[model samples]
Target: MTQRPVSNPAPANNPAPAYNPALSGNPQSATGRAYPNGNPDLGYNPPGVRNTDSAVPLRRDKPVIHNYACKDAAPGNLAFRWTYGSNVAAKNRDPRVQVVQYNEDSFVLRQNVCVHWEAPFTYLLFGNKGALLIDSGATADAQHYPLRATVDAIITRWAQARGRRAVPLTIALTSGEDVAQNQGLVQFAGRPETTIVPKPLHVMKRFYGLANWPSGTGAIDLGDRVIEVIPTPGTHQDGVSFYDPYCDFLFTGDLLFPGKINIGNDRDFVASLERLKAFAADRPVKWLLGGHIEMMFVPGKYYPRFATYKPYERVLEMLPAVIDEAIQYARDVQGKDMMLIRPDFALFNGVSPDQRTQVWPVGVPNINAPRPF
Candidate 1:
């Protein structure tokens, strides 16, 4: 018993062990502790201590949650002044690509009329892992259009804002045959960390996961953001439309816009419009964005072809009611070869190639004089 009571003391040259609240189970003093409020490394505070730093909260007081499963769509802004290019390319100083930030994760880009007469609109959407570019504009030369450069800058800025290193891009087109929309595809070639969907019917079907060519829908998963790809091949055989649930935007491309609807297949055009109407019946569609806006503010009036200047251009965002109206108009002129001009859109069903050169006013026949039969 007397031997057990005797204990050896630490050497005089030895230093004292460091104090750790986690290991030692001791309360840290305010002055000697590295963190004045509490141990920063600890997940929870000691019995009597309060966590002063908000970074590690005691409990979730007001937690914010986003229920993506809900069918309701998120609202966004559409109030923007689009850059309508000048009549003369030499005098036009507008940016080749006009980008409008609809929301935090979505951008609406438009090519200047000076760059291409069509001045098509493109959509860029971001998700957790990557981004999706809906359509390429009408310009191929990046030196003149700067599409790739503009997209690169946007992706870079988005990644930096989200503390990410890289964001992969996927380029898709509404219609592979549309020269006004796919001319800029060449700019994205050979780009690093990019995937361009081949402009072919079979390839697009596989790329978008559409088992049925012109009936069944497909999907493009941009991580958390899933875009519904509907088979809309009325204006063109390879044409497809995209529906974004987040923004509730139905991107109809050239199928339906505030411009001329040149119907490639009359039956398919009507069927596609009916499908769109049914699809939008239950779902809340905020807007039906299209490839281009050729209509003017005046009812059934559009800017002259190849006219770069459009001062009185109509609003680009079309309502879902336009789908019903379009379906009716398309069915009325199902087999006709004349242009049916409406207040919002002009239906060019079976119109001849030469008819495109002539401007048709808002009327049933859409012709000013009798044709030389």
Candidate 2:
């Protein structure tokens, strides 16, 4: 494949290594790798297994950006999520929704950049029969974000592009009971030609053919587009990562986004990361796109919780090795009470100084795991 034309991530301390090209059959592929193949350092090692003569394998190709999203903010609450970044209503543009066409077949829709900082991303992947709409946003009111109308617009566009044939949308949350992803469910529930994936854990487990938790893997075939449902239950018990081999895009709802990582069961979280690491290795992955972006422009920096607008931020596309770094970080600090902070994200059991952290579960409990907040 020809080299992709995109700006390289800006650098920071211990920034993720570049992608190695040795496996790509081109010595120049190593041009983008974080480490060289013959370095005798990088290899697959499970938790508690250390490569004595090798360097710790950190995230590969973690996006490095130039500056903070809010560096220009003068003072006051303006810099906070309340008001920051691109003005949604500058001239006459509506702030209700922003539809970005990544390609004819794939599109990304988000609540107004100003609607909510956590304006979780909603992805629509088109196929021969219909489209798969992943995640709702944090808003319920149509006037505020127009979730339904925006979806119709996408459907219309998709149909027109394909010789005027409609591609209906099948709605599914990245995880069950996620307020940020399910708030818009009510808006689409009454619409025609829409099927909402059942929210019950057992129902979902059966629907996806997942026989058991953590060990079971399932998939959904959207006509020709196939999506693997890799059970990732750390950020939330029911949380799962959707891997789209068609687009080489892994939509990790909350398992590993740009923001703070709120872990419920550390064991499950670590195990989940390990699972993703192995899954990614077997496939050709282009981008690991998560539901949200919280990593600020500078490396390892992040906007505080609820801070909406991020002017200087890392690219939405992240490296798959982030799973590895997170796993290693977890293994290196097992039961230490210290939440590991990395350049891309922070890990914790949703516990902090004053707030009450959720009781981290012992084993993979049912989907009823309480949240950190």
Candidate 3:
């Protein structure tokens, strides 16, 4: 029998709020909304937090699919396409800053540029003591000459706002991809010294050819404020979620998004979600800093219900259901002697196919199983 994809059940009666033009169209002006600046009281902070030495699981799962259609989609996946115009050339123009205060000290600064995407490249800046920049969009593509120029302008603007010529900024990465980290680093290299936190040394080495990238859990002292790196592996071995203690904000790379967690890299995708859940349980996350969406949060007046539905929490709560569905999908495909699985899903599948090979790992048991309903 063919399996159907599982769809999350809609919340009872509480049915998510109707799409309001104000909130949907003009999120910046939405009142009492949590994120990128709305209500300070709604922000999250753990009252008494303690650190545990437990590390995320490292054992790998066996390969399950060989000849999966989805695995063949990576190179052509529309999701990875950079249809948005380049950022390099736009950087040459003057920098513009728009600040949205989430609370008394935390704010998101958006620097506009001529990138293909309409949303501006956002810099999540905090005002505790020093400064922290979460995910410096695209900064190094030769085509995005404007993007690199724009980032430089923003850095200068940040320095001016802090009232220091050489204010140190800590750049945090969600992954080690060039568009996410390298490009931005190359652009910022000329500036005064800045500390960059990249997780899972292996990815850094493979992607940037750097053997010693920052690793492990630690606090980044930025003068007055402190940013904590909560290693959440899964999207990539080095994927990490950052928390700005003073500002009560969480920057969850691609682990969790408003609608769906991007499953481009499935194994790390699921693992990353688990890590995020544990991180949130220990530290209350007031705001969610996403890569594509500037900011996101669960909406409601009741604090407990709101907390129960925070984006990361919601993703964690729904993961088991998602995984079960994926497994069912594998079963159905196997029945048909065909396979379809997300390309990233192949990571933990145990079969080694050359990364360059287009063929999916074939002959694994129930490798082509169908998705569960």
Each model's TM-score?
A: 0.77, 0.69, 0.45
- What is the Cα-based lDDT of residue 145 in candidate 2? 71
lDDT (CA) per prediction: 0.78, 0.65, 0.41
Q: By TM-score, how accurate is candidate 1?
A: 0.77
RMSD of each: 14.3, 17.4, 20.6
Q: What local lDDT does model 2 show for residue 299?
A: 55
Model 2 global lDDT (CA atoms, 0 to 1): 0.65
Q: Which portions of model 1 show Cα errors greater than 4 Å?
A: 1-71, 353-373
Q: In model 3, what is the error at residue 331, expressed in angstroms?
A: 15
lDDT winner among the candidates? 1
- RMSD in angstroms between candidate 2 and the native structure over all alpha carbons: 17.4
Model 2 C-alpha lDDT per residue in residues 1-373, reported as the tens digit of each score: 1122234443476443454545422223433233322332222322244322122222223311211122222121112231234433333243566667775467777675566657678888776667788988988887777888888887875565344444567888878867888888888977877888888888888888888786778876666666788989876778888877666778988888877777777888888988888888888777777887776655555566665446666667787777777787777656656555566776766466123234432332223222213
Clashes of 1: 0
Q: How many residue pairs clash in all the candidates, one count each?
A: 0, 15, 42
Model 1: per-residue lDDT, tens digit, 91-123?
999888998888768999999998887899999
Once superposed on the true structure, which residue ranges of model 3 sit more than 4 Å away at CA?
1-114, 118-121, 126-129, 139-165, 178-182, 198-200, 203-216, 264-267, 294-373
